[model samples]
Target: MVGGYVRKSKAKGSSNVSYSVTCATCDEVNILSHREVGGLTLPLLHSSHLYRVHDVHRTSITATLLSHMFSQSQGRAVKQQLRFYSSANMSVNLEGNIFVTGTNRGIGLELVKQLAEKTGKEAHIYACCREPEGTSAEALRGLATQYPGKITIIRLDMSDEDSILTAVQAVSEQIQTAGLNLLINNAAINKPDSLAQLSATGKKDMMEVYETNVAGPFLLAKLFHTLLQTAAEGHTSEGDKMSCRRAAIINISTIISSIEKCPETFAQAKMYPYRTSKAALNMLTRCQAEDFKIQNILVTAIHPGWVRTDMGGEQAPLITQDSVHGMLNVISSLSNKDSGMLLDWQGEKIPW
Candidate 1:
């Protein structure tokens, strides 16, 4: 059995709508939002058919469902709104102060670069890395230089607790009481370890990876809880809504973290250290999502896919920009319902 719930909101010069369906056969709820611009409706894919959708464009039912939603939303009162409708590679307008860790290279650098392109002077992006002056972060430095006042490069070693506290203090002093809009825990370490290499050194490597991947994010969230809450509180009118335009914690996870899919993936290469650590990180995402719900701070795990980064290697299929682009769309379209879920770069939920 399936049931539908429709909601809409008007923002600036555009009309946004959300039509969600609850299915007994599928996951609990799937939300598909849309934007109306000059009589044209652009669909924002936020489907709940996790088992059915592995790719965004492949979901045939998405258009049909949006078509029905548009028809149903006519003459509806503006009691609630989804606020934004976006797709992969689409333009997005984000407000408030944004923070991202691991901005030196790979997806982190790409995220900062793309964000700087979208953000204006009114907004600020704090791009954190282990070394702001290091040779590796030269590109990030150049980006910060390009953006000037729009982007601040902060020194943060995610594995070090003192460094996290220092980073938090630095960010807090700059944003004042306005609070942080987004916290992307994009910094992570994937120390190479496998079942075939089980030894003291491998076990040591596991702990180091876990410390950076799981424990670092945990401390960062704990220290920045106040800033996140302040940001969320700013949207009192839309307190019920969860959005990146407000307060959100985006953990840059990987689909390789999926334990259920391990049978197929493990055969390819048993990335024991990286996989297990990310699995723990997913748990952190869920716990934070639950704990921060009343505060209206959204938290979710996102699998950025196999990208051609230093970590992903040259043979990896997807480009960093493409993965970040898709992730931005997914992050922009997140709602209260998405908290605690594990979603891919394409906005489809991944199995635990």
Candidate 2:
């Protein structure tokens, strides 16, 4: 807003008329000379405020140049104004089209509370739960009351393929009219059942945790890629100009997956299967990030700080809100630079 641009165009001979215009976004000025200028209507060259950060700024420069040609015919040339806003200058609305898996309890529950209760944005929360309609926890009921249209309780059992398929179909239908922008894969199980416990995890239970914790979110992202793309397209179509941003995927992971930083001592330390599963999830985060780079989808794992929950128990170090608040801040700070990272609640990069 502090500065604007000026542009000028000129015709060579006595029969030609000259034109001048200025852009406020960038100080760079352009001058054009046309020999035979007539009743040709051209687009007005707007300043490249948003395009400055993109790799393809040339496209914008060309468009601006073409617009300048069109502006000469009209006596009053048009100036497409641009105003720059940074994270420091403007408050970022951290809520929008969101899809959160495993939102019935713990971090997932807290995420819904913060996004809907605190931020109060137009959030479409897909609260994926085993028993979505009737959870034992009354806090969720309170949440539903507080945020009516913002929350949609979807019955998604991560382990059940049939349930996942059904949920996917419903999601596809819901997003056809609108679209999903944010997806949080927060539903995970950390029960302390070891390899030796009950002879190979009953095949049902083995796949159950993996299906929900890992495979379900993986499949969901794959399923919603097109929806995300369309939503991003809509965003660009609106505003002064299009943005390069896309949908985001946040995977709730544990520091126990960190080979070097894993806790040395825990009361229930013999859960080999759970530990291995989370480690695999960490790898999955990296895989998704690497694969979806072009889609502009940032996939990252977060170690929600130790909290007092059903899984963390009463003796945990942090409370639910404290851990979730920090994680939310970290999420709010996410940019293109921080994609494909394994970070903690404090936004510090966690060890692999």
Candidate 3:
């Protein structure tokens, strides 16, 4: 008795009875004696046996039972679809409105490119860069053309507050009520300087680096706080109890920022200005993670490895695609538990 309504009858001097159930999906009638049903009631046995024996979508069965049990409950119609695939070939799709900074070249540009390739058609990507006419910008524009409406190039000079505000306004107009699901604080600058150079410059290089690396993300997060909150709110409105949707902020930090792991041999050639600013960025990430917990926003710091870009130089050990790909996988798998952590491209935790 697996799919239909159950009726009970008492038998004289015997505790056993017979019941019949009709499968909802296959409409097959099954008759079972009380002894065969074991300890389970008729309805429970029917539901469990039908699910185990049939290939019906699990969600469909749950929805049907809920609807039948609460016919007057006015539940919304549910649609169920199932897809089966091998674990070896699984691919994750990143959905929602995404905004990435420093996208004219290097890691930021690569992130935009790969996101376009991996996400669904409904995904909207806003690629931000300071110079729109540069060679790297031209390449990003080509990607925009290739992807049609999925990619948009915006001007964002992270060092300038006016430019940041303007870019935020533009993104706000585009996203409107949908809000931004992801914000990547990837724009940064690095000027190689030693202790000797710092003595002559009197904090000028440090100030410049801090402005773009630390202050930029701080201002950007402050300005976009509402939009991120809006995205989190929208996730709750979906009415799906199992939904893991959330808004996230990713800070592109570096492994060189690690104070504990800095090589003793390279102390003289240390880029102090760059390293200190990134360390400060990591601290900011921790603060944001704590403050944004109530809003359900995930904040994290990631080191993109030594990628061979304009900043990383030609001799760098890692390539742009590999670094970006690994970081994307890390970002896709992040949960609230991973917030405030300093992780490398491989998703391994790095010591502060």
Runs in model 2 deviating more than 4 A are: 1-92, 135-137, 192-206, 237-246, 263-268
Pairs that collide in candidate 3 are: 1-21, 2-46, 3-22, 4-22
Residues 62-116, model 1: lDDT tens digits: 1113444445445462221121123333466577899999999999999999888
Residue 46, model 2, lDDT: 14
lDDT tens readout by residue for model 2, 152-248: 7778888777888888788778768566777888888854443245454556665666766788877888887777666656665443221212467
For each candidate in turn, the TM-score is: 0.74, 0.66, 0.70
- Model 2: weakest 10-residue lDDT segment is 46-55
Per-candidate RMSD, Å: 13.2, 20.6, 19.2
Looking at candidate 2, what is the lDDT of residue 236? 59
CA-lDDT, candidates in order: 0.75, 0.62, 0.72
Ranking by TM-score: 1, 3, 2
State how far residue 59 of model 1 sits from its true place (Å): 22
179 Cα displacement, candidate 1 (Å): 0.5
The residue pairs found clashing in candidate 1 are: none
**lDDT winner:** 1
Q: lDDT score, residue 319, model 3?
A: 60
Between 1 and 2, whose TM-score is larger?
1
